[model samples]
Target: MNTSHQSFAYTLHDVTCLFRKHFDRRAIRYALTRAQWRALKAIRRREGMSQTELAEFLEMEAIAVGRVIDRLAAAGFVERRADPNDRRCWRLHLTSRAHAVTDDMEVLASELRREALAGVSTADFEAFERVLGKIRSNLSAIESGTEAGAEFTSS
Candidate 1:
């Protein structure tokens, strides 16, 4: 790879690490583990998602997601109700207690965005986003086994 590509890779890794550290620092008061916050946010985003679907979305095993759900339910941050149509599955929902914490998380995210983009110009940011989208599309195509009509399939 060229120097420029190496620099970009380094920047991405550093920025991602910094952002995670920053968020983890700010989120300590909630007493939720990183995985718990991720699960909560995912459930909050897609209320009523089955545990299996949430597991898939989180790229975790269904058993692992179930354990997270159990912990969250114990904390009163979320609840799992029996799926009306699927007796074998449970639908997850965020409890009222989680709403305020999730709201704070959103505020923290917005503040972090502002801090990160402090000096970045809108045009430059837009171009950066476009490039990122292209890269993401290429990676997704490769991951999905659909690159350049490769005639490959995977479950």
Candidate 2:
């Protein structure tokens, strides 16, 4: 194997670059960054999540998530309503404008996925997905303090 190609960080960086390139080409029109798009999608699905929950779901720092929400709220894409159960906590809601953007995002995501998986077989795709799941689980476990980094193998 080529030594350079064996670096996991290099592979991860390349994938990130590719994703950013495609996202720019395909999803930049909604005036939301990829992180904002993810937060919006989560808000749409959960409908009344708090900023803390949203940050946990997104695996982002609460402050970072708050900034994204701030931008979205300013853009009229999301609204923060006082939680009935907890007046101090605000629940997130997608605005009608956000719903419209979510619809476009779904289509864009589907198209991007199709393009990304062009020519890949179903079995191969399934295996790839399983590998990705394991990677995510491993990283998440490490991140949440359940396990040490020793549990993960650097590929």
Top candidate (TM-score): 1
Could you give candidate 1's per-residue lDDT for residues 1-155 as a string of tens digits? Answer: 44456577688889999998999998899999988999989988999999889989999998998898899999999888998998987889998999889999999988988998999999989988977777777778889887633322222
Q: Please list the C-alpha lDDT of all candidates, in the order they appear.
A: 0.86, 0.87
Tens-place lDDT digits, model 2, residues 1-155: 45554686678789779977886688877677888989999999999999999999999999999999999999999999999988899999999999999998888878887887899999999987777677788778878988633443435
User: What TM-score, over all chains together, does every model reach?
Assistant: 0.90, 0.79
Model 1 alpha-carbon drift over 4 Å, by segment: 148-155
lDDT of 2 at 124: 90
Candidate 2 has which clashing residue pairs, if any?
none
Specify the poorest-scoring 10-residue window by lDDT in model 2: 146-155
- For candidate 2, give the lDDT: 0.87
